[model samples]
Target: MNTSIFSRFQTRSHGGITLRASAFAAILCAALHAHAAQDIYFNENTSVSSPNRYLNESSNWYTDAGRTQQFEGTLSSDYNGIINTESKISASCASELSLNSLTYNIAAAKDYNNYFASLADNASITLAEDFNVNITFTPETGWNIQTIRMFHNGRITVGGDFNLTFDKNGSGSNGFLEFVIRNDSASAALTNRFQVAGDFNYTAVESGSRLRFVTGIGQFFVGGAMDIGNILWTINNPSSSEGANISLGGLTGTSGMISLGTGMASTMTFTNSAQREAKTTIGYTGDETTLNVTMRASDAKNGYQILRISSGAYGATDANLGDVIIDTGRLDLGMHSGMKGNYLSIAGVDGVFSATASDSGNIGAATFENGEWYAGKIAIDIEGELAYDKIVFNGRFEKTGSDRDMGFEFAFDAYTMRELISAGRGEFILEDVITYETGSSMAGTVFEGNTSGIQWEAVFGDTSLSVSFTVPEPAAVAAVLGAISLAFAALRRGKRA
Candidate 1:
């Protein structure tokens, strides 16, 4: 048998000191080559038809038994060559992966654990062609990882399911699974494109877990349904401070929906500047869609505003683009900090619109600032046998001119108006009322014989009426009574004569 290079080095070390020094130099040279041989290279320009078996022992690839494999050169595959039996493959280089009219297919039903465990730092993947590819990873039992980051700058088309699982107790602080599609193309049309036709399921099983789908200057087009279960999915912009704008491309079907939480006490928050476009729309697919914010509690404190849209142009336009239809959720207007403006401002020339607060829900003070107060309508409907304190409209309740014919309808069972009078104020103006119906229990009721210092000025009519309340001075009431008594005594004397 031929003596190995390492064996020959050990044999010569027992000779003189000069031979021992030469033997050490030979061992150092062998170690350097072994380290350089660990990198696997694939050049598409040379032998494009050969199947580059990932586990071939005779090739330039290095494997740690059947556990892990690492590749270093630019990989351009045109067939099913990068297959994994029971090992995880990590392909990385200083530059990105160049896919040229090739399909980098991964074998199905194979459990390749921690596929990107040894990815080169700061290395990204680029797709040169708009071909189809499938990369699947089904982990075995008891496998946990911190994060898996995939940065692609090309048009990728997935042909199968893109399933990802973030195991419990696997991630710590600054640990998150993120997929970033950066725009590196000079052409505006082919900048950043990702289309997936299969089901995209991402599951996170830990607290403080976050899954982010970020895009630079391109759009994410999903041809199939996307289900993100129990992860705080943040859509971030690559350039500005605003959230990334996404187009759903009509992926939400009758049974498919883009759900955020797992029907629990979870939150999906959007943060940006105070502009209308900064507001995030849950169901902006331009179809009859439903955005479900499932709350497990019934208390108002427990049930927070599922959709908190805080911006200047929420209802600014007449087209009503991005009109959201929430399934079983509560809307909070002017709820965010430093957002104390109009709630709904609709231009009156389009058509008449109505804003209603019904079914035991509270609309807070100064909630409405109509563009034309007399043009639109406001309704406060109450059902069942319940009484409320008051519905305060703290802002202006007036018309454009002297025509006070604005529609204000109040339909309730039983309630009391809490003495709408200012102390020491003697006069109040009565505006036009469209409809007012006091129940039969309190019909024709006039509050009199009460020294509560309250006076009523009521104008009753067949169609419309207005009521005002004020406090009168004590001296004025006594002088009016004295004049009435003197007149009565003079009339008695004339009758006797």
Candidate 2:
């Protein structure tokens, strides 16, 4: 550990100088090794373009329906045992009842003695049917009939139907009468008394199913499996903090925008999905139009952007944040091993790599390192082998603004009809075969392998692929050390003299 040995040795002219230069060279080599071990670099000139801005857009949208309702206190009367019931009760459920059945008092006049009363107790009572009768409670005051109690049930279930009412007319003095329908077989019973109030929510699923309340405040439409309660639709009521919230299951096949708010300005959730063929268009009222064309999930796995148009064929301006547009071309999923082409393409997206593939385009496995960043992972099928390639992150540095437009692209080879049929194992399967004319000499085949001589070009724009760095070269560094050593030797010799 004699640090001065090297310095003092430098003072020795001939032999010592050579040894000092050699030591300095060793230090320079070590520094070079350290610099070479870095991963990821940022090129300031280019930026990572947002992955095909339409990655989530599609042609068709999966849908589920629901409904909800709220009622306020209201007063109405039931006369002649006739209840005016509303028709067409859709998927509507009430939480509580404020007002159930109504009560009334009637009087029988004159001498209406021998009489009978009728009562109809049904779940739904209609005013079209009527019943009337009267009874006498007289001779005591030598006057007219005073009052009779009229009772009605809100929640009623009936096995049969009958008329319910009270009447008096035959004789002079009025008679006391009341209609009573037993809840034994076919009649309504008494239940809670509550009125339906507030707003009602309704959501459509398979097709056209609607629930009409007084006024609808909000509704929700989820695209996948879910558990629903009495309330069909729900909206995220951030203000109240107790209302319903909508959940999106997965990407659908069409483009759609969910809007929340009143008047012109509103918040929106845009989505789309495609099956065989579809068209999805989305945009704000004042924004530019954008459309993405894609294939079904089945097609995507088979190495085909079924739609001549692919996702991200369009650009994203400030107006396209929650807006998605897509169009699904044809059902040209070749008939081979249930193989269908996929048109969904993603570029310049950073995060965990999650993809599953089959056929020759299957991704066997992938490795993530250096912060576990998979720069670009593309799956394509060649012949019968699934080929997956992920660019390893060499290195990275500080960044500002948007992500760079970094991605990989592959060109496919053309195949003849005969080759496609034979390659698909007797199933007509073609990969990346477009009927339209194109610049590339690639041919189209219903069932065949991808084109040859295809090279993937990594697109780097706005940002540098490698981080900005400059390590001093060994020659330059050694020269600096040599000069320092010379200076030190002269100073030491001068002191010694």
Candidate 3:
């Protein structure tokens, strides 16, 4: 599993972009990497490339250091390794070294680059257990992606799972390809896991040439479970920590753009609420930070709302931002407020958060977030049309926070319901999604069910509704539940015929 013949001289980069080639793509890198099949290189003109050289010695492994090309051990996936030398050796890189795709160049030797050996300057590596690398790319141009660059006082300790995978076909302009990690791990706090997880089946191509997944300082810790096709593209984490520890559980995705954050300090957390595939936007930034999301407004996904959170275009601020507890969700069509917070809770039991800022392209002022909400456990501000008792969300829910309540009930029926405003100053309604499609059917009320066996009224008029009643106590649809309207049936005319 160890072989030789990879000596091409270098300069490359990924995700953050930097792979300068044009001498005809560096003369098509030996015809797109044919560096003699089982190619391996890390001889950096020997001298041991520096310090303790002996990665299971094959003459200290070479492609050129006057050792006349070498390679006698370590590498699988039919071999093709290249680490244009940064020299430093640690024992058993997966049983004395392994690679199928490891190209972290320090000097271009024609980008068939490879290596995982990340230990910069104050270098350090202790692989006591696992260390697999089916992928990692920093050798660009001939884009067959692979990279592993963890600088600034680098250090690694993998007791298990450093598994890799990212083989995106980069196109013209040499169509970029990447799998980056500028991680600053000194064990960033212990036990390595960094698993990028399975199902990279690929197919989200729009390739104007810029495939991505960038990272830098979220410190490591992910053995698996990063679902949603494992965040395949466009994940830009612009470094910033001090108290920027990371943990994200139960995430669903269509996450087209996730920007992470800026100068973090307070804290960051997301334990639930994530179901995207319709205009996805999950952003974050500085200040007080307190994110907690649980879902149970019947977990909407098809009736409307998989996810919607916006600090607007990603600059977040109430002078820095924080606080988003949505017990269940909705919003995000337009009119965003860059999320300046002080409050936006809408939590549990009957918690149903929905905001439809005038539908039709939602031009403005809807998911308004500049913070002014102060409701807890009870907020029922029904302002028209929101059905999903299992599929019915014709859009329309606008909440601005702060109402005062302990109870509110309104079962809704749809087909264009009209008018209903039960403003909860103490915040009411935790168990009724929305009922008001907006006027006319003459305002409905004409049920002649079996008035004589042949009757049907409500072509679009009386569709069936129930903002029912109960806001602490206001009964009389027959004392609360006797009759809530919208009824039909009872046909028997066979005997007369």
Best by lDDT: 3
Backbone clashes per model, in order? 0, 88, 46
lDDT digits (tens) for residues 1-497 of candidate 2: 67753574453357444567666677779987654411111111111132211101111111111111211212111112211111110010111111112212223223321111112121222221111222222233223322111123322211122112322233223222322212222212222111111111123321322111111112122232221111111111222222222222222222222212112222211111223221221222223322222222222222222111112211222122121111111111111211122122232232112222212232322111112111322333223322322222222211111323222222223343234445655333222211212221111111112223221222222222211112235685688679989999999999999
User: Candidate 3 overall Cα lDDT vs. reference?
Assistant: 0.35
| lDDT of each residue in 147-235, candidate 3, tens digit only | 44444444444444444433323324553445555453443422222332221122233334333454454443332223333343322
2 or 3: which has the higher lDDT?
Answer: 3
lDDT of 1 by residue, 88-197 (tens): 33433333343333223333223322333212333433333333333333342232222222233434444444455443243255344444344432323223445554
How far out, in Å, is residue 321 in model 2? 2.7
Scored by lDDT, model 2 comes in at 0.23
Full-model lDDT for every candidate:
0.32, 0.23, 0.35
Q: Pick the candidate with the highest TM-score.
A: 1
Candidates ranked, most accurate by lDDT first: 3, 1, 2
List RMSD in Å for every model shown.
25.2, 32.6, 21.1
Question: Candidate 2, which segments miss by more than 4 Å at Cα?
Answer: 1-278, 283-319, 323-411, 414-453, 459-497
Cα displacement (angstroms), candidate 1, residue 475, comes to 46
Q: What is the TM-score of each candidate against the true structure?
A: 0.31, 0.22, 0.27
